[model samples]
Every structure is written in structure tokens, then in C-alpha cells.
Target: MQAKEIPVSKSDLLRADLQESLSHSHIDPAQITTFQRIILTTDGTLTEILEAYLYEKIQLVKLSQEIVASAQEIKALDLNIGTNIMNRKVLLQGKISRRNWIYAESVIVPARLDEIYRERLLKSQEPIGRLWLEHRVETFKEIIDSKRELAGELSDYFLIKSEDKLLSRTYRVFSKGQPIMMITEKFPESYFIDK
Candidate 1:
């Protein structure tokens, strides 16, 4: 699968929205720089970047997986789900050195996938990037939305202050010219700090 160029809006590239959202009311130039490096870099997978940053293996901690009704957003992505489309929700934590650094949720259309890939997704604790690589699936990611907000559970899990918001980006992954999954990743502030 060949890599495709990801289009970015000129406003998004020039705006400080990413920095402002990640840094509460006050902006930190250093943090903004790191934020841009991580969040705005569309060249590689999050697993790859996080692994490089932490200098440790990124482990996928599967929280849960269940079949569910498709949300309007998922449906609107033109996934080509039939009347009985099998939708699965997978919740996972991306951990390094046994510390949970990222919380991710993926909405997958199993019916759109082959039997082998579908089973791997259901049974394995591998990150999506790894799965894609192993299966040789070519994908295009479009970052649809992003936000900075204090999530209580995420903060508690990451041992962060309740007032410190986590930065999150939601993106859709397209393969074979069709939307296959939507993934949302929430990163704690500690991820941006130098160790």
C-alpha cells in the first residue's frame, strides 16, 4: 500500500489552536513546540512516535471490545455498512514502562474487514499501526477534530492534576478508498514533559 499525502487546511497549519488547547489558558512555547511535533506530525503513527519518545516498547492494554450500534459520525464516513453491519468498539491504553500514557478508542467495522484481520483485531492486543503493517494495509488518516479538556478518569489514571487537561485528536482511517475505522487518542500532559 502506497502512502498518500494528507491534506491540511491552511488555517489549521497557521493557527495556534493546537497550542492553546493543550496549554490551558496560558501558552508555553516549549510545550507548544512539542505539541506540534507530536500532534501535528502526520507522517508516522502515534505508536511509533510515543515509543521513540519514551524509549520503551509501546504496549497495547486492551480495555474492552464490544459490538455496538454505529454513531452518526461513523455512519456519515461512508463506510458502506449494510443493514446488518457489524460494528465493534475497542478501548485500549497505550502504555510504556508499565505507565499508561495514552487512552485510545477505536470504532471498527468488522464486516468490512477480511476474516483474518477481523480476528486479529478481536483477539490481539497489538496497536493498530502494528496490525496495519503486518497485514500490509495502506491507509490514509484525516484528522477530523481535536480538543483539550480535563477528563477525570484519564487524569486520575495518569496521576495528573484534575485541572490539567489532556490533549486529544480524533482521526478517521481510510483504506481502499473507504473509511474503515475512527480512532481517538487522548494524551496526558506528562507525555510532553522531558523525563
Candidate 2:
């Protein structure tokens, strides 16, 4: 059976002001280049990029994953799973050289996933991109938006002071034409620092 394509809602596109952020930002050119490299690239796992840029082994830390009935916003993504739909909220961190480089949260539709994929997602500490590649799941990513977060829990997690900001992007992953996951990743400014 062919997977049904999930339509992107107009509201979802409008909610993210990515164009303004990318086109009008005053961030340094090098930093902008780094952001584009990380956020714009549809290929390769982020772990690979971090390893190459930071010159260190990356570690995946699974903070939490819990099954929930639904998040209204995630449900709005219109995943094709039937009434059995359940959302998995996953929080994890990527560290390099013992320093946290990225924090990520994902709203995954377990009902839409194959049994093997669901098991791997729940049990593995590997990056999701790596897992997708290992399973040879043909997938496509849609970058919904990007932003500069100046304050909040994410900044606190990165130890950013009041005046500092973190770069972030929100995206969705689709496999077999079905929307399977929604992810938001926040990167610390230190990731762009020159060695």
C-alpha cells in the first residue's frame, strides 16, 4: 500500500518566519554560513557535521521519551495514523568533547512507524538521521522555520547569558510520503566558534 501524502497547512508555513530570519539577520557572515550549512542541508546526519566541524566524537544522550495521546500542534500536522494515534515526546542532547552542542525535541507518531523502527527509536541512543540511514528508509526533510532564541529554557540549557542567543530550526521528516516526525533543534553559539 502506498503511504498517503500529508498536506502542509498554510498556518504551519506562516507560523515560522524563516524568510525574515534568513534574509534580514545581522549575524556575522561566517556564523550565517555555519547556520546555512547545518540548517539548510537536507543530506547527512548532524552528527557527521558536528564531528567534522568540532573535530570530536559526538555522543547522544537520551533525556526522555514518553508516550502521550496527542499534542494539538503536532496532531495538526495531519499524520495519517488512524484513531490509534499516539505521540512520543523525545528529548535528547548531542555532546562533543563533553560539551553540549545541541538540544532536540521530537514529536513522533509511533502508530505510523513500523515495529522495528519504533523499537530502534525507543532503544537506540544514536542520532535519528543515522538510524534512518541504517534502516535504509528513504526520507525527505522539510525545514519549517528558523529562529534565534534569546531567552528561555533552551538558553538555560546551553548556559547562554541574558545577552546571548541560540540558533534553532524546526523541521519535519517524511518517509514513504507519510509525515512521521516533527523535530526542533537548538544549537549553541559555541558550535560556530573557530578552533
lDDT of candidate 2 over 2-79, digit per residue (tens): 999999753344224444444344433244554454553343577777777667777777777777665344443574
Per-structure clash totals for the candidates? 0, 0
Question: Deviation in angstroms for 41 in model 2?
Answer: 4.8
- lDDT on C-alpha atoms for all candidate structures: 0.66, 0.64
Query: Residue by residue across 29-76, what tens digits does model 1's lDDT show?
Result: 344545444654353687777777667778787776777565444453
Per-candidate TM-score against the hidden true structure: 0.74, 0.73
Tell me how many residue pairs clash in candidate 2.
0
Which regions of candidate 2 deviate over 4 angstroms? 1-31, 35-37, 40-43, 71-76, 79-96
TM-score of 1: 0.74
Candidate 2 residue-wise lDDT at 53: 69
Model 1 global lDDT (CA atoms, 0 to 1): 0.66
